[model samples]
Target: MIESARNLDALKRRLASLDRVVRTRHAHFPFGHAPLDRMLGGGLARGRVHEFFACEGGEAAATGLSLILARLAGPQATTLWLRPSAAARQGVPYGPGLTALGVDPAHLLIGVMQDEGMLLRAAVEALRSPALGALLLEIRGRAPQLDLTASRRLTLAAEQSGVTALLLRLDADPTASAADTRWRVGAAPSVPLPGNAPGMSAFDLTLLRHRGGRDGVAWRLIWDNERGLFGDGRDERDDHGRQGEGREGGAPLSRASLSFPAVRPAADRAA
Candidate 1:
């Protein structure tokens, strides 16, 4: 009888492992942009690390990317936001701000740590928890612990738990990473609404890197916070009624149109 019980336990463990693999294999979130989604081979892979960095005058855009993903995780899902205490003190997410960003304040849990080591340890632990829907780690410039090895470890943990991890590197140049996708987000001026009201926040998102896809692609999208989706600037066109600059008929701009180099800043144009 004891032998039979042991075998049953082992079988249960195997089933659980198989379940994780199956879920991870099929999990994905579509960005709702056809060209970008096509380039992504469907959509963003869940259970993987996606890095978002800011370009010149684009810090808010990077945070917007993370928040949009969190919204995609489902309404009931909770997000674990881990950052250094210093960063938190600088500007923590408040209830009103989260509402404006279309994220539920109640669904967010902010964890403030002392330094990089503590923050990363907390991130790993939080990522391994299956209850958390997503993990967001804020790295100031290049946090020492965010090196390739550590990123891989976090990626594995996310894969095992089927949780999505986003690394937000503020004011940092893009570098090689173990993340599945890398994006450089830049802010775009919003379209003016009636009565000169400010419209939805827009972003110029450049795909800097991907594991098995093309890079140096860019898209101009506006965030519809209420719906939690990015919109192509279809309603707003140039004076000629054409789509807009740097894009073709609301489609993502190709690498050639981006002009700037991916993975690093371009050299001085005048130099």
Candidate 2:
């Protein structure tokens, strides 16, 4: 009887493991941007470390990138935002916007490192913890080539422990390591929004890279700081937009034409 009971327990454990694998395979962030979410193969998974390497030349792009991190952190989940103090204080006042989105401000653990090594190490360790829902590493400029092995280990750790880490950095850095998804963001001044007043905060959000697809598809969005929400941008020239996704007259929103808007300054631009 005891042997049978032990076997049953093992079987239950196995089933649980299998269930997790199935779920992790389709990890995603529900950012309310269907087009953007669809492009990400259903958005970023919880157990995987997805890095965003930001490219140069655009506030629309940069702001959109910050929103991506904020979205992954979710409305109310524990987050560990690791970066330098100066970055946390001056360059980006990102936490307030996150709180505005409904996240528990107190639950956030903003860690500042004296050196790069400590920062990366803390990042690796943080992902290993079960309490954290997401780990965000904001890089202001180029991604330095510190230790590939270490980076790989961190990636493996995230996968093993079922935690998500986002290595957010600039695009100009040619030496950055390969990531699950690579994006080049830029601000397109002319991008339009779908609803409300035309001039209400907005940006040109481009999806520069997907795991397995062509690049250069993007979205234009209207960002309203007063109300922390993003909506589609309606441009007449952008005949295919969120407005006309299905109906005959509806503009067919392309991966390129649609915009993903976000409220201003998640903290300040890191550099």
Candidate 3:
């Protein structure tokens, strides 16, 4: 009888260890930005809900940044983006533009809901799918349906499924929610390329709230589409006025530079 009891305890311990390993694997992934990752306690947490609010005239920037993050979160997994039908007025996603941003259009699925209620319902349901890599819910204006209770529900589903949830809010103010992190995203001038060409996409990001870390920090990030990563928006130039190796903590842009074309997806321009 003592031998059997010992064996049972060993099994229990083994199971517990396995659980820990699984949780660790799904904990978080590095944002590739040194300072930002350090501030986030290693990286952005997976299997949790995060909120991104768009500043004035920055709806496109917020959407673009969120999509980039979703791709990073689950590069091999499919991402489903849910939006209300009314959002069609802003503009639908453009395929070429998405490709230029380093996100493969083939792995993305767009779902247009009839109203906010249906959109939230679909978001919760999508969060329950373990196969899904990331889920993005684009809510415009005041979203009453996404209350504290609804956010909690989404969080629970994400925990069970190990999927990251990104909420993009346009024309809305921050409200109470169970989000792990809240950010305000706006467009920033990009570095001009040779021959006065438009450079990569840039964003001015502000961390409004972080659940277990510091907040009210800001960072300027430049998206490197070719590498599918983000830089510190400090692009170095060589002697010939060509681009050089980029490093963090470089000098900020001195003058107004070009930004991404306004014809991209989720942009303010009419489709």
Candidate 4:
């Protein structure tokens, strides 16, 4: 048992030393998308921060994003849902949706705060402790007036402690951030039917920014509404998120079969 434990520790140490692993890759959890993992060189760099900005008025992208975060949250790590707007927490069925993504409600620490500063404080607090896996902050159209000095300080603290900080800004401006990696996700066609049937609600994950990777051409993903799962695509081979090089930039968009509700713009009527 002692020998086994020592081997495990050594492996963990190697994983911890991964430059990107600290922000995205962690042993406990798997990447949201297998393809995305390839792009991330594993997964979201653990102990690093990734900022997701939802400029779209509605959270048409949220359902898919939820699954991503849930996948990132390992069994041992905790997800701190901080300062969600009324629509996000009360109006939208987040807990249920998250449950569908395999994230247990019991493991989520949701806090409804009134201001952005409080949310920042919570991020700082969560980063102070290495036990945390990921922190998801749902902002209500916030201004990007956070202290950069403080944010940099927190980044350093996260490096020392080993925690991933995720910022989800709904209906917020894209320029309102100074994070490590920034991304924007939108709803696309889910899984296509057997034949002429329409596809369900799926996602189009756009990599707005990455530390070291090519930009442009978003990855199209299918969403499994019932099972709360994400499908790779019409093709079976590429379960991973690999960019098809020869494929044209703007592929013809197939119309979806299911009729999902129109998402409203993200507003700031939070707790």
Report the number of the highest-lDDT candidate.
Answer: 3
lDDT of model number 3: 0.73
lDDT (10s digit) by residue, model 2, range 101-128: 3344554555666556666767777666
Superior candidate under TM-score, 2 versus 3:
3
Worst 10 residues of 2 by lDDT: 1-10
Candidate 1 weakest ten by summed lDDT: 255-264
Candidate 3 residue lDDT tens string, 91-112 = 7676666777777776776667
| Ranking 3 against 4 by lDDT, winner | 3
Candidate lDDT values, in order: 0.65, 0.51, 0.73, 0.53
Q: Cα RMSD (Å) per model? A: 12.1, 11.1, 12.2, 10.0
**Among all candidates shown, the one with the greatest TM-score:** 3
TM-score of each: 0.76, 0.63, 0.80, 0.66
Worst 10 residues of 4 by lDDT: 1-10
**Error in Å for residue 159 of model 2:** 1.0
Q: Write the per-residue lDDT of candidate 4 for residues 134-189, one digit (tens) a residue.
A: 66656656556454675676577667777767777677766634466677766654
> Which segments of model 1 are wrong by more than 4 Å?
1-26, 232-271
lDDT of 1 by residue, 1-271 (tens): 0011012233234223322222334567876666567778878888899999988766656776687676575345667677677665555454444566677766666666777887777777767766666878888866766788898889999888888898888888877678999988776655566676666666677777899778776666666666666554442222222334545555542211111111112232111
